[model samples]
Target: MIQLVIVTVLLLVLFFGIGFILNMLMKTTWFPIYGYFAVVIVFVVYWGNAGSLTDNLTEYSYADYIPAIGGLIGAILSGSAIKALRTRGFKMF
Candidate 1:
């Protein structure tokens, strides 16, 4: 659907921004990738368990994590590419 596509594009842009910030602060190519994965795993786990102490709500299905994973991958790739380009004397505007 169009809504899904729009949401996905927004997520990619947001994640890429996060990745870019992380790269700028960390100054390491691999850190953003690892950091993104770690954050996603923690987020999914926490979200899945959010209702554990409540009225016995069910956890999210695996499919629910797909978008987050996709976003993380997009972020990692874009961030690393940006870092590489900047290091190679390319100006990002």
Candidate 2:
């Protein structure tokens, strides 16, 4: 369906855009993959429990917002994880 296509594209952009920004900020490449994966995991969680939350966001149209939320969560998680890894002497090469 067109909706699914749009959702996928938006999710990819959201994930990649956040990842690219973090990669640039930290000067590393792996962070992007981390961010992307984080987003995917979050999306999976949301997908698993859509009815519970989707009903609350009645103002919004379409379920694609789930991935957008995932992207935001992923961005935050990615930043924290990257920082934590660096603090623990994990070097990205």
The most accurate candidate by TM-score is: 1
Superposed model 2: Cα runs more than 4 Å off: 39-93
Deviation of model 1 at 49, angstroms: 4.3
Writing each residue's lDDT as its tens digit, candidate 1 over 18-62 gives 777676666655676777778766665555546552322245544
Point to the candidate with the largest lDDT: 1
Q: What's model 1's lDDT at 24?
A: 65
Clashing pairs in 2: none
lDDT by residue (38-71, candidate 2, tens digit) is 6555664456644765553553545656656555
Shift in Å, residue 39, candidate 2: 4.8
Clashing residue pairs found in predicted model 1? none
Q: What C-alpha lDDT values do all the predictions have?
A: 0.66, 0.61
TM-score, model 2 to reference: 0.42
